[model samples]
Target chain A: MIELQQINRIFTVGDQQVHALDHVDLSIQSGEYLSIMGPSGSGKSTLLNIIGLLDRPTSGTYLLEQHNVTSMNDDTLAHTRRNKIGFVFQFFQLLPRLTALENVELPMVLEGIPPAERRQAATETLNTMGLGERLHHRPDQLSGGQRQRVAIARATIMKPAVILADEPTGNLDRHSGKDVIELLEQLNKTNMTLIIVTHDPEIGLRATRQIRMVDGRVMEDNHKR
Target chain B: MNTPDFIRLTLTAITAHRLRTALTVLGISIGIAAVVLLTSIGEGIHRFVLSEFTQFGTTIIGINPGKATTAGGSIGVFGTERPLTIDDALALQRIPNVQAVVPVVQGNAEVEAKGRGRRTTVYGVTSGFPEAFRFDTAIGKFLPADDPQAPRALAVLGDKLRTELFGNENPMGQRIRIGGDRYRVVGAMQPKGQILGFDLDDTVYIPTRRAMQMFNRESLMEIDVMYREGTAEKIIVKDIKRILQARHGKEDFTITTQQQMLDVLSSVLNILTFAVGALGGISLLVGAVGIATIMTMAVRERTAEIGLLRALGAHQKQVLTLFLGEAVVLAAIGGFVGLAIGVLGAQLLHMALPAMPVHTPWIYVVFAEALAISIGLLAGVLPARHAAAMDPVTALRAE
Candidate 1:
């Protein structure tokens, strides 16, 4: 479960103050498939960043799993981010030098896992993503859809509680984008909390719960499918 | 992360830019090689000079006129000093443990031998000269032990002076004129090469009292006292001082022990070695600069990777260690390569110039490698800290 109350994110540009998030509040329960959809500069990405613990709110009281995460130290925030949250970027940010398996094994590697155990687990994870044959291929050598799948595998390798995808299919073709969305939906069916931030109405409508924002404020929330 | 994994990661990053890494390594290697080679030469010269000085014998003490005020800044040479005479030299021979005494009066003279005249240094010495200074006679014999006050007009030609004035012809029993005095060549000395630029093979020796009359001086320039081995230096110096002070009615002479001279010379040469080593260290400092520059550039290039590592739960300390590890590995490789090149270069130099002494001590070899590693650690600090301090969000967004 995640809760936000009176969360405000402000940006100072030279002499003026811009409110990226204007005193908005929202709540979500476990196993909810949700999407934050708005036009450009609607603060959807900022909200997602705050929820992912990548950035702190200017004024916020954020509670994730009944713990006040806004008051956590930087190191604790990093620990919580790695253990409780996962991210799939639109660009499929895989390190170019690492193979598909190595990219997926990175999270466990940072966790100080042994080489043999992590190697086996990363192989299985990549194999389940239908990248068994492409396990040794680098990102530069893989197809766009395959790269996105690798990124998805890397995100879920640590078995985090929630998955945050920011325009996960923005850079892919229609077919691969559909494949990525179906894979994500499959994970959602397994009771993983899935939150997506996108401008595409089709992708936004696929979520069981949808929220639309305007000028840093939540204008619409449709919780019933 | 575990050490192996951490090393692998660092190695991966270093090998990513092969050309850049090679260039950085080359910079550090050149510095280490410079340090090794320069210090090797300095140490070689240090030993060479010491052996040359000690070859003449180390137990001999020289008593020079005018007590030098070595303890404080004062001009003792300008004081009224009594000139040490042949009598002082004869008195020192009576002291216990005294082996031989040679009262010296050195002067340049034109010697005419075999109708050929040449200018050479003439040494006014006694019969104990050859034994006391370890000089050998290549032919005939040295000056015989005759009466000190009145002795034969015998001359011992130096090795080079024999070759110059006599050629292949035997100079023994030949008459040579030294400063308008005719003397018979009793012997020719064995070839002893130069000592501190003084040609030991180009000098002539005669009786001390005769040379004092030839140079026309009342006091001997110096009196050399040769003592038996294992004799304590303080006792010999004390006995010589007591006799000379009693005869002169004051302590007007300076007695210099060979050990004291050796200690002073050894310390001066050590400083010379350290100075050259420091000069080489300057280049090593430049190499450290090269490492710092490359590491800083690497940090800039890998900002996104750093952010990703942080996102994957790598701590700030981990990021710092990764960068520092890369630096240390680079420097260590360079150090090894530099050591090989330096030792090989020293061998090649010795082979090319056999007369030049070249020695590479093992301690310097070990120290040079350690210096390279420490330089790497020091150079990596600022850049590693900068990389570790980067904000994850901003770094991830960087192109």
Candidate 2:
């Protein structure tokens, strides 16, 4: 479960203030398949970032499992992000220097898990994502669809309770996009709360609940189940 | 991370850019080499000066009247009419630690043997002059011991001076004129060589009785004495000073021992070594700047990697240690290499010049290398801190 109240983020660009997020309030129940749809400057990505604890709200309260994560130190925030949230980026921001297996095992490495156990767990996760044959390949060597799968494997390697995907298939071909979407949806069915931000109405229609944002404000929250 | 993994990662990173690491290490090594070479030069000069000084005998001491303590090393003033006397030499022998003291009455004079005339120094001294001046003869001996009543017409020529005056003919038992006085060459001197600008070989030795009589007036301008073993020269000097103060009723004479001469030499070498070492330190500083610049560029290039590590949960301290690890490794490797080079260089230099010994003192070499490493590590700190302080979001955004 996640909740955000009265979130407002303002940025100064050479004496002009741009309101990136304005008084936004939202909540999501556990295990829900949610989609946030918006145009370029509509605060969709900012909302995802705030919920994932990657960026701070200028003025607001954020509760993840009813704990106020507002004044947490950088280290604590990183730990919470590592343990509770999984993120899938549109561009597949996989570390280029590491193999797909190593990339997936990165979070475990940061957690100070023992190497043998970390490798064993990461191998199982990659195999479940159907990247068993491509485990040793780097991101640059894999196909667009394969790279996104590796990123997804890394995201869920720690078995976080929530998955926040920002355009998970924006850079993939249609067929590969469908495959990534189905895999994400399957994880959602298994009771891991999934929040996907996309501009496509077809993708938006796949979610149980759909939210539309316009000009830094929530324009609509429609039940599509 | 465990230390082994940290070390492995550090080594891998450094080896990733082999040429850059090598160049950086070379810079530091050169700085260490500069330190070694400069100190070696100092040691060589010290050895050379010490050898030349020891050649003139250890126990021998000289005293000269102050010539207003002038600019060019205390030059004797022109027309300084005072000369030393036989009574002064006798009086010095009476003091404790005065082992065979001698006084010289000196002047420039011409010598003629078989119409071969050469200008040479004429010195009238006591019998102890031969041993005190470290004379080694090729032919004959020195004058007999000075008897205040018996005036001997004796002369001793330098080894070179003998050949110049007598050629194949023996100069012993021959007579040569010293200005207005004729003296027989009782024994040709063994060469005493040169000592601190004084050409002892070119001078003739005669009895102290004859010198005072020949030089006409003698008020004892100087006195020379040798000290007993285990008794410090300063003690003898104090006793002589006390006796002289009582006899002359004034503390006008200067007293300095052979140890004082050596102390002055050591201090002079110390100052010279310090100056050369300071100059060498400048080169070391330049090397440190090179390391700092390289680290800065490395930080800039690895900015994305830093972000990735941070996003993976690496704390700022870990990032800082990563960079610092690289720097310390570079410095330590450079120090070891430079030490080897510097020491070997000193040895080869010593071999190339057998007459001059340039020691590679480990204390100076090890100390300088240690300082260089510390400086290099310090140079890396600012860049490492800057790299660690970069925000993960902004760095990742930089892509």
Candidate 3:
């Protein structure tokens, strides 16, 4: 479960204050499949970043799983990000120097997991993603779809409680984007809380719960199921 | 992370930019090599001079005529004060722990024998010269212990002088004219080589009384006293001063102990070594600058990688340590390679020129390595700090 009350994110460009996320409030329960749809500068990505604990809200009381994270220190926030939330970037932010298997193993490495266990888990995870044959292939050597899948695998390797995807299919072909959407939907069906930020109406409508933002405020919320 | 994993991570990053890494390492290596090589030569010369000075025996003391301060610059010339006489040399023998005393007179004169003539250094010394100065006669006996006040016209040819004058023929009992005085050669000295540029093997030795006569001087040049081992120099020096002051009615002579000379020599040599090492350190500083430049570029180029590691839960200290470790490893390897090359080069030089001494003190090797590593660490600080302080969000968005 997640809760936000009066969240505001403001940025100063030169001398002007840009309200990236204005006074906003929202809530979601466990296992909810949610999609936030908005135009450019609608604060959807900013909201996702705030929820992922990568950036702090200017004025907010954000509660994740009944614990306040807004007031946590940077180290505590990083720990929370590592253990509780996973992020899928639009660019598939995989390290170019690492192979697909190494990319997946990175989270566990940071967690100080044993090498053998992390290796076995990474192999199994990549195999499940249909990338077992491409374990040692670097990101530059892989297709766009494969790279995205590797990023997805890396995001989920820590088994975080929530997955936040920001335009996960933005750089993919239509067929691969469909495959990615289906994969996320399948994870959502397994009762993992999934929140996707997207501009695609088709992907937006696929979620069981949908929220639309205009300017910096949430303008609509609808439940389709 | 575990040490091996951390090392592997750093190695991967360094190897990724192989040319840059090699160039940086080469800079450090060249600096270390210069330090090692120059210091080796400096230390070698230090030991060489020390040995050269000590070869005459370290317990010997030299007493020169006239108060060293009163005479100003012409202390050893005749009429400076009462010249040191043969009696002064005999009186020193009465002191405790005194082993042997030899009166010394020195001058350069032309020697003619078997129609061959050459100008060489001529030493006027007592018979105790062999035991006091550690010289030995190779073919015949040294100057007989005749009366110090009056002795026969006997001469001892140095190995080189004998070969030049007599051409390998037996020079014993052969008459040689030294500065217009004919003296029968009694012995030929073994090859004692050179000491501090003084050719010991290219000269001749005669009785000190006769040398004073030949040089037309009334005073003995110096009275050298060889003291026994285990006797403190202070006691020997005090005894010599007491008798000389008693006889001359004032301290009209300067007594220099070998230890005093050695102390001065070693201190001067130590400074030479340190100055050369410091000169080499300038090169090392340049190498450190090279490392700093390269590390700064690396931090800038790998900004995204740093962000990725940070995003994966790497602490700021961890990121700092990673870059720092890479720099240290680079310098450490370069230091070792340079040490090998430097020591090997020194050994080769020693082989090529056997006369030139080459010694590499082990302490300097350890110190040079430690200095190289510290240089690397210092050079890495700014860049590593910059890398560690980067904002993960901003870094990730950097592309």
Tell me, by DockQ, which candidate is best.
Answer: 1
DockQ (0 to 1) for model 3: 0.49
Q: Is candidate 2 or candidate 3 better by DockQ?
A: 3
lDDT of 3 by residue, A1-225 (tens): 899999999988999999989899999988999999999999998899889887789997999999999989877877787778877888888877678998898878777788899899999988988899999999999998889889888888888888899999999999999988888887777788999999999999999999999889999999986
lDDT of 1 by residue, B137-233 (tens): 9999999988888989999999999999989999989999999999999899999998878888888999888888898888789999999999998
TM-score of chain B of 3: 0.92
Candidate 3 residue pairs in backbone clash: none
lDDT of 3 by residue, B1-399 (tens): 778777877887888788888899999988999899989999999999999888888989999976645344654573435779999899888998899999999999999998999999999998899999888999899999999889999999999999999986999899999999999999999999987688899999999999999889988888999999899999899999999989988887888888999999899999999999899899999999998998898888888777767766677788899999988888888899878888998899999999899999999999989999999999999999999889877777776
Arrange candidates by TM-score, highest first: which order?
A: 3, 1, 2
TM-score, candidate 2, is 0.74
Local distance difference test scores for all models: 0.90, 0.79, 0.89
Which scores higher on TM-score, 2 or 3? 3
Please give the distance, in angstroms, between residue A41's alpha carbon in candidate 3 and its true position after superposition. Answer: 1.9
| Clash list (residue pairs), candidate 1 | none
**Candidate 1, DockQ score (0 to 1):** 0.50
On residues B1-399, what C-alpha lDDT tens digit does candidate 2 reach at each position?
667657766776788789999998888887778887788788778766776776645665554443333345434543342333455456667876666677766777777778878888877676776666455566777777747547678777887788788777888788788766788887877666676787777877776667667777455445667655577766677776676656555544566566778778978987887788777778788878888998999889888777656655677787898898888888777777777788788888878988666866668877977887797789899999998898876665565
Candidate 2 docking band: acceptable
* Per-residue accuracy of model 2 over A84-142 as CA lDDT, tens digit each: 88888887777665789888987876677778998899999989989999989988899
DockQ of 2: 0.29
Give the CAPRI class of candidate 3: acceptable
